[model samples]
Target: MMLRTIKRLSSRPVHILGLSTYNYSHNSTLSYRKLTTSASSQTIKREEQAETATVKKEEPDEEKPKLSTMLNLDRAQMEKDRLARLKRKKSDDSHVPQAKHIKTLATQTLTFKKEESVDPLPEPSTSRRGPFMTLRDLQERVASYVPRHTQYLDGVVKKTYVEGRERTPNDIKLEEVFQKDTLQTAVLSAYVWEFLWVLQKLNVGECDLVLVLHAKEDEMVHHYRRNLCNIPRTRLCFPNMSGNVNCMHSKLQLLFHLTYLRVVVPTANMTPYDWGEALGTGRSEGVMENSVFIIDFPELPKTSATPDSNPSHTHFSRQLLHFCKAKGLPADIIEKLDKVYDFSRSKPLGFVYSIGGSHHGTEALKNGVCGLATAVRDLGLKTKKPMEVDYVTSSIGSLNKEFLLRMFRALHGDDGKISVQGIPKKYSSRQLAEPAAAADESTESESEEEDQSDNKLWQDIRSSVRVYFPSRRTVAASKGGIQNGGTICFQRKWFNSSTFPQSLLHDCQSVRRGMLMHNKALLT
Candidate 1:
């Protein structure tokens, strides 16, 4: 075809062809250029078609199905229907007896079957078996029984918190005593859940009941009316409460009868969690707490104890009486308490508690870092006696440098805070000093002679101003061999182990896996 086109162009005029072909040497040159142009155009068209096909392949116009198309959809549907039908048949056959004879009688009538009761969640364990004594075991060992010189009180010494065992609902024997003497009165501070559970457990049916309760009036509280209906017996109290922040935060359990009076100060609440019913999480995987129990076996039935005979009891009675009176106890309960324990007869023990109101917090703060001379006299530590202030607590955050020094100065007549974490490395020492300045001679003399009785066995406390707190290792470990009792542990540790105190402290190596702790307590 090219040759035919060249022949036809050859017959044309050279100048005419030259003008048409521009600068072509021959008409065949024009034919060859056309041929090359046509070939190049065809090649470009083929490349463009290839590029368009690749783009279309890379980008899908529509989405694909998620489930496998190869699956047997019909078979799966049939299987599901068959399972549903079998479930329905099972439900229908449930009423019919398995025996053929009994199945025939199913058309007559069948009684509804009752379901078995499901058990509630298990409670957390407060105490696990240990081969040796933790500070807790030592604390229990040192705590003395209350209502001494009485049949019940003496037997109670062994049954008290001395065993280092977890507290149980039935562990409290006061329940039986209260039930027996229907005239006995009992007062407790608790959360609603705890109160209800305790009330149910104690079996204290309307015999005198005074409760200091804490809990919000939520939907659950309304639903649990069987217990909430008895709200009349409780004097409502809450902490961080909207109406009142410091509204009766004290956890006191007082049982009063004409014959005797029992006092229990527990760090734990009435809830199962407090009594090791709820397992802890995170840092509190293992929990520990401190508690104090005082049984004032009144010198009733016949007068045995007197103002001087049992000064410790008298002092405790006075403090407790003051607390109750200030708490605005019921007139009847107050009257009953007065008949047994007379505050006038109580011996004075120097202990200033932190109470409600800004004034109290301020006073606590002021007392924290200052007023050493007065506290020394108040605590009845002979200014001349080598006495030092030792602070052993579960929560270290409760004390700081400025505050600790002030407390030590007040108790030991010196000043300083030590360096444990951010604390300084200086401790206050209580050297022989001049007489402590006190409010009155009567107050000084009153606090003086009583502590002597207990001190008869040992010398005065000479431990310096030292703050003990849980270490980082203790918090991380799951071991609960350390005492949660704040400063109380020091007294218990020393008092009980005066004979072999180190034995208890060292026992952790054999038992609790070593001195690991929580609750921030800095003890064995």
Candidate 2:
């Protein structure tokens, strides 16, 4: 019975030390032995198999697949919600109102701030790194250097024509030139800062203003409104221009008085720099000098007829009307001036202008080079000799052989006789008298001969012509140096061209040696 009990105990699974031998009781005679029997072995194997199965099941829960991708869709969804909330908050805040006075001032301040920041001032190519300067600051700097009392217009008071190095004689301030109460209205045209400086110069606050400028319609209006808001009445006129037209480069002023209308054509712009303003100190002074042609036309009597109908209508008056008409000025203004003013006094002075257009036939003889021809003819200038031509200028265009030739021909009061379709028709009567074939052949031969003659004449004219401009050396050594010469430009491509007359080029040595010249003049 004891043996049976031992065998039964061994058949059951061992709890301690796995399957190792152990003595359960000290009194028992049966020796401990390995539990290698089939029943015991089967029981031990079944327990181990159950433990491994459990471990396998738990491992799958802890370990994850390495190739699996994590999703961030929820994060993206949260970010979108955050942005939507921010937009709603901003919209809600915008509906809130503020005090009226504070709001008005704030709005104006913001408007100006925004405007000032919109257009970035370009840094000059030659400018070095430094603290930035605003346009207003630059204007003040330029104005500071100018002499306070530049004009001494009393010619009889000053008999000596020459003033010392620092002083200028016979100077006239634009502001002092106009009579205060007598000035009724004014017309002003210039290159830069037209409204700002000119309005103060004229001192015609109550007068009606007619401003001619070159800019887009909206831009021009905005500029005028920004600068001249206090003016009582204003009119803006743009020169009639096409894509090929370069610029509206004329500077003119018209002042209407109680008894007369005064016209002043000046070589200077509205800026202080162009009107006897210097950029240097003491003896080494840089000056911008310009000349003016001023004329006063008397108001006609009421008994006289309109200028168009009157026999006394001078060439200058007719041309002025034509120019106004071409530039798209107010018809009523032109008519009023024509009817009221007598321009007979202006006959002694010649008005030369360049209006942009592709004019043909006889109409070509009315402006630009052709207009110069007309002026020379009217003035009765003798051009029979081989005339020497000298031209001084601040700006140079893309000059070519053809342009120089035409200019030479124009100076001699000739049409240049270029072969264009409509121009030949001006003398079509001569062609009509001959047979059709003969006329065509004769015209061709005549044109060829004329061209040869023109080529020969061009060679002679080219040799005699000279152009004076500020060279690099001249500009660098000036009182203001290269910075003030920004307005003068001549492209390298034009100068480098084969057809450019390089031999005739000369440096413009101003009388005031250190001063830069912004003058444009032609001498024959």
Candidate 3:
């Protein structure tokens, strides 16, 4: 194809191709030259045409200003254009409301039409009509089923009561002595969960609860956490027993009601077993029997005209208030007892409290063993010169000769006789009934007199006092048996001590056979 093209170009005239004759030496050279020249010219012509076409396609026929051009523009014109665009946009937007705006408008319209008004998503129902869903649902079910308040005599399921008269039973339920229909409760116990459970049974959950227990703070919180409803209303008080006191063993309850305040002093702990609730399954009789002393005080009249408004100067009332103060009770509750409640009814009652630490001087006459003497004296109870006192206790500490003598004297309202003649010189010197007898003997006759006096005192104590405790056999035979008798403790170390009055240890067994006795009573 190249040869044919070259031959064709060679036939053409030099003048037509616009090339000189001197440029070629031979016909072939001339033909090649002609082909080269003609081809080059044609390629150049095509290149120019392509460049022109591309330029025409890519470049605009006329240049237009950039939309954002502002180097030398008129400010007024730019502002005018911007304002016009905004006005047009506003008109467009006004024709169609936004989604949120439309929803708000619909809500307003429906709100005006009571019949067609939309309610919020309905609240979750509390009624048990639906299936059990959450734990709260189960709690509500349980609360509804359980009685809010129960009778103290409710445990006496064995005997039916007559309509007209109240039949007192040999064993009383813990709730029976509760400030009946109490508004609030303050419980002092050694146990936590069982006490809280007892409170639940008494329907005391509705009101505020002040729990003073000898339990760990975390344990108290854990127990109360089970009853989510009472958590807010319950307050736990752990006595500062970090001092001389070992534990908060006070078994007291202050039941506040609308009309009166009931003070309960019970030998029972705040446990179901102690409160007359039977232990183990299918047992109708309670494991232990306890005693309670309950006294009700009417609400003091608002007017000063009433004699009840004046706080009782009675020894019992003053001593009780003092005990409350010492225990760091709520100030408001103590005030209510002192001023808002009538203590005139409490006058005949005798109160005895044993504070832990040593009491000296005048304080000695109002606390511990001495306090018992004070109470007995204040009560004006008839007493023989040689009183035969029987002290029955479920929980007994180490018993010594000196302690028995002091106890005997307290019962006889003669706390002055706090010493034992034959005890160690150190202890005898501190609490000698006759300091002269403890002095150096000046003669053999004087020494004989001192010895005689000591002998007489020792004989008096032995004849007058009797301390009763449950024997191992007695505890084993009880309803709860040996296992549950852990609470009724008398350390082997104390029992084996040489000074222990083994002779005074009369076997204490409850009247109700097979039942343990938790009662602490003084039979004079």
- Using lDDT as the measure, the top candidate is 2
Ranking by TM-score: 2, 3, 1
Could you say which candidate leads in TM-score?
2
List runs of model 1 lying over 4 Å from the truth: 1-183, 190-193, 214-227, 231-247, 277-289, 299-315, 342-352, 360-379, 384-390, 413-463, 479-524
Poorly placed runs, candidate 3 (over 4 Å): 1-170, 179-182, 191-196, 215-230, 281-284, 305-309, 381-384, 415-452
Model 2, 406-522: lDDT tens per residue? 677678776433431123633532423546666667678766865787777778776899999989999898766787788778989989998888887899877765667777788
Q: For each candidate in the order shown, give its overall lDDT on alpha carbons.
A: 0.35, 0.55, 0.53
lDDT of 1 by residue, 1-524 (tens): 10101111112211111111112123222221111222343453343244322322221111001110111123234334434543553454433221233223332222211111021111211343222235663344235322222324422221112113343432333333333222246777643234434543442332356766544455433344443443333443232333444334466777764445665555545553344322322233323333343344453432633533433344345445555675667777665554544333233333234345432212332232332333345446534344444344443232223333234334543321111011211211111122334323433443364234324312232233344444444544524433432322234343343353221121111122322222221111
lDDT score for residue 451 of model 3:
52
Which residue pairs show collisions in model 3? 152-176
Which 10-residue window of candidate 3 scores lowest in summed lDDT? 1-10
Sort the candidates on lDDT, descending order: 2, 3, 1
